[model samples]
Structures are given as C-alpha cells and as structure tokens.
Target: MRRVVQYSTGNVGQHSLRAIIGRPDLELVGVHAADPAKVGRDAAELCGLTEPTGIVATDDVDALIALAPDCVVYTALGETRPMEALSEMSALLAAGINVVGTSMVWLVTPRQADDWLRVPLEQACAAGNSSLYVNGIDPGFSGDTAVHAALSLVTRAASITVQEIFDYGNYDDYEYTGTAMGFGNTADAERPLTFRPGVIATIFGGLVRNLAAHLDVELDDIRERYEPWYSDQHIECRMTTIEPGQLAAVKFSVEGVRGGDTVITVEHVNRLTSKAAPDWEFPPDGQSGVHKVVVEGEPRIEMSTSLSHPALDVTEAGCLSTAARAVNAIDWVCRSPAGLVALEDIPPTELIRGVMW
Candidate 1:
C-alpha cells in the first residue's frame, strides 16, 4: 500500500482526499490544508466523510515532509500563484516524495514547458530521485490522452479539435469565475487573464504541442482566439451575478498550426447558463457538461464524454474527475523514473486499477 498525503481542500482537493481514503490500496497518511480553518480538523470532516481517518490536516510543510509519504496528491490553486505553487511542489519533490497534481496546468507537458519553469522542477526531481505527474480533466485526459486514443481509430487525419463545453452555473469559484474569467464584467472591459494574449497558449498550448510531437507534426505557430458572449438579461450565477450586457460566456480556441493550416485545436465554450450563448456549443441533449474530441479525417470520428455523479451536479462531477485523474495515477507515478512523467509514459492499464466493477 502507498502512503499518501493530500494537499488542499478546495473543490478538487476535497475529491482527492475522499478518493485517497476510499482506495484500499492507498493509505491516507496526512493532509496539508491551505485554509486556516481547515488546519487541525480531521481529514474526514473536510471531505464530508462520516468516519474519521485519524489524520488531522496541518499547515506545516516541514511536518508533512517528516511523514515521508510515498506520494502527495496536490490540487492547490496554482493559476493565481504559480511561482508559489511551484516552490511548494519542488520542496516536496526535493524531499523525495512523488507527486500527482492538477495545479500548474502548464506542466501538463513538462517537456514543452519554458526552461525557467522546467529547470527547477527537473533539479528537484534529480536531487531527490522522485517523479512528478501533472494533469486534470480538460488540459489533461480530454485534451490529450483521450484525443490520442480517438486519433488511433482514424485512417487519415486532417484537423483535430478538442472541446470542453460546460455551463458554469454550478461552478462556485468566485475568484476564478469573477476575476480570472471575467464572467460578470462588462463585455468591453479589458480582457481577463484567461483571454489575455498568449495566456491560453501558455496554459493549453502544451497539450497541442504534445499532440504535435506524438504525431511527428511540426507546428509553425500556435494561435489563440477569444470571443465573449454578453448576457441579454440579469442572471444570478453561483459565483457572481451577470447583469444585462455584461459578459456571460466565452468561447476560445488555441490552435496549433502546421504548414499554414490548423492541425490541432483546444477549444472551450463556457457559459454561466446554457441560455447565455445559444450559438455556442453546449453539452449533448439533457447534459450540462462534456469533453468532446472531433477528428476530421477519413473516418470523421467524434467522441464525447459526459461525467455525472448521482449525488453531485455535472460541474462537481467534472471536478471529481480532475481529482481522480491525478489520484489514480499515484502508483504509476511512483514506479516511474525520477523526472517529469507524462500520461503517455504510463500504460493505460496502470491507471485503471481500483475502479469499481
């Protein structure tokens, strides 16, 4: 059994904590909670578990390192404070702890990451002989792993597109939705951090480049396009309120161009409500969220994956999948070499372990 430490207790972290506790092959050794209120509380209380796991959350990094778990499931918020997150992860790696995480989306393809961002992580892994795997739902399974699996079915390939269509009504991250995404701001206001020039490319471009590398396709450039949808009426969302004429939704694409043609694309259509953008893409009938991959080639394959939980809504289920992707890969990551590990490096069978029958 692998000893595991769960970091953070946010939307994704809560799910990670629960998954660690539920897995019989994994032992919940410790938890590092970011919120002061969460510190000193039982891990079970933080993740809605009825029975206590006998592990209390702590804020002391040194104490967690002292425990020396086999792996750490890190789901902390890295978008706003990437440097800090990197430092934290590097510290853990330097302490010889394997890590699988959803933070630092750019690290989804560490090989293609900027040298400055990649160097420290590489050094940490080298110093401690540990491995790090970073992934999540969109920039992770749907955009790369699942897309590659679909491409294997095509006889010939022309253009490939991976899309995430979701209604964000239930997404309750106010800092992310309100500020980072610019959901409730005026349409004409300065572009949000997510849509700023080169931002999408920096975040999702690694997935495109990774795909290009796997296909042996050289991309001349990576391009980005952003479109915002304005609300026609006042709408109250879980995160923030959208007034009439305010930004309600956004559709953006990051395209990998090869030989002057768009070869690979990562696109997203995110709306506060399904009614916000009738023209933009939506989940399949009766669904609220989906990750779709469209391969325009000889076979013209289109694969759509929708996730839902009996107890949680579609958005929360999606968050759960993000956590599961990281948590499930713990064993594979621990067995891998002492550097950055990608999804392609780990066999599919290794990730399917411990799933319910």
Candidate 2:
C-alpha cells in the first residue's frame, strides 16, 4: 500500500482525510497538525472520525519525515506563511517523498514569479527522485479542469466564465460557515493583502494565467475587486439574525487577453445574495452560497455546483470528486515530463472518477 502523510487540521485537511479512508490501495500513514494540543492525538479522533485506527497527529514534522512515508498531502492554510509552508513541503519532497498539496490561492505549479515557488521544489523532487502536485477542490476541479474541458471544443472561443455558488443557508456547522472563508467582521472587507502575494498566480489566478499562456497571448492585465455583504435590516438565518455588516461576497478576478486581443475573464467570489445583484449577471447559487462557477464564451457555458453537507462549505461529494482526480492523476505526473504543469498539460480524459456509477 502507498503510505500518504497529511498535514492540515481544517477543511482542506478534511479533504485529504476523507480521501484516504477505507482505501486498500493507499494507507493512511501519519498526520501533522500545528496545534500542540492536537499533537499525539489520534488523527481520526481529531477529525471526529470514530475508531482510533492507530494513526496519530504529531507536532514533530521531522519525526514524521523520518517515518519515510512515500508521499505527504499538505492542506494547511498557505496564506499566513506560504513560503515557509512551501519550504517545508520542499524539504519533504527533497527527502525523497512525493508531495501533494492544496495550500494556495489556486494551483501552485507553473508559477511565473522570479523566484517561481514550484521550480526549486520540482528540482528537489527530481533530485530526490520524487514528484509534486498542488491540488485544490475549486481551482483543480471547477475552475481549471472544468474550464480546460470546456475550452477543448471551442474552435473560435471568445471568452470563458466559471462560477461555483454554494447555498449555506442550511449550513448548521460553525466551522463550515465561519472559518471556511474567514468570515469575521473584516473578513469580507478591504484588508491588507498580507498572505498569498501572488494572489493572481495563485488559485484561479494561475489557472487564468495558464489559460492565457496556453492561448499564447500576452497577459493583458490582472485586477482584483471585492464586494461586502451588508444587510440594512436584520435578516433571519435559521435561528440567528444577521445584522448589517460587510463580509466579502467576492474576492478576486483576472481579466485576460485572447489571441484576438479580446479580453477573457476568470473570477472568484465568496458569497452573495442571488437577489442582491441581479445586475451583476453572475449567477448566485442560492441562500448562503458556498461555491459557484460560471463560464461564458462566444455563446456561453454556465454550470452551477451545489453540494449537500450538514456541516462543511464543500460537501463530501465535492471533496471526493476533486481528490479522486488528484489521486488518480498521481501516476500521470509521475510519468509526465518533470516540471511545473497545469491541467492543460495533461489530457482531460485522464480524470480519475472514483467509480463509473
């Protein structure tokens, strides 16, 4: 069995945790958490997973590496200290362990920054005879792969837009609503761009950039805008009423240039009322939306994704769908030309569905 180590303590980590469960081909090896209190606790329990299963969370990353797992799945929040976290991931890959992660604004490979984060890691992985891939539920599935799939048939494509609206009205889970998107008072507002410096090249930014690169068009320009949700009157949500305050409804957008020099656009938004912005043209998932992707072309392609989970921003179905693509593509990256790669680098037919049902 292939041993996989995971290093995330929240929703992203949850994706990895659920991915490894009950899989005979892969073994759940070790888990790493930042909280000292969580250290030494069984990972399954930390995740509210019943049955001690013998896998424990450890604070000692070095020790975890010493265990020499074949691969590490990193899902830690990459915003606070992305470079540092990436450095740690690089070390593990250098130590000869294949690495997979989703700690970015978008995809992490095919970077353009002068330092270009993934290069050194790829070089290290190659040196150590390992491989690395950065995967995210949205950026990987709904945005990039989905867009790539759509663009495939366009002989004279004009533009593409993607949306993933989530209805969180029924979301009874606090962690799912609050922290999945950092929804405190100033969370949705204009705050200092502290982490994820390459916000454009991160998340959908990189995918947008990659698309432009694939089209062989010079990047026209990139811009980011935000919308704050404010309720004039107290709005009732389940048991609680939300007062007037600005939490973000939209985070960022990238406007690209096509070969015709026409502008192509890709955007990411957090939450918004479907009724609030009828003028925006962007589709709203429903009440308390979680994930939404809208793609527009010469004609148009609109896909609305909704998942049902009692207590998470992304449903189990969403995570499973995304992870299955990443997990099954492991062999593709292993065999492909070594370097930073985007979804466009691989064939869409390679998508690994958990089952044919």
Best model per TM-score? 1
Q: Which runs of model 1 end up more than 4 angstroms from their true locations?
A: none
Residue range 280-338, candidate 2, lDDT tens digits: 44434333433444444544655555555576544445655555555655545655654
Instruction: Give candidate 2 misplaced runs (Cα > 4 Å).
Output: 113-116, 167-190, 194-204, 235-242, 258-262, 272-299, 309-325, 331-341, 346-350, 353-357
> TM-score of every model?
0.98, 0.79
lDDT of 1 by residue, 114-231 (tens): 9878999999999999999998898899977789889999989999999999998888887765577788788668888888998988888888988999998899999999988898
What's the lDDT for all of these models? 0.90, 0.59
TM-score of 2: 0.79
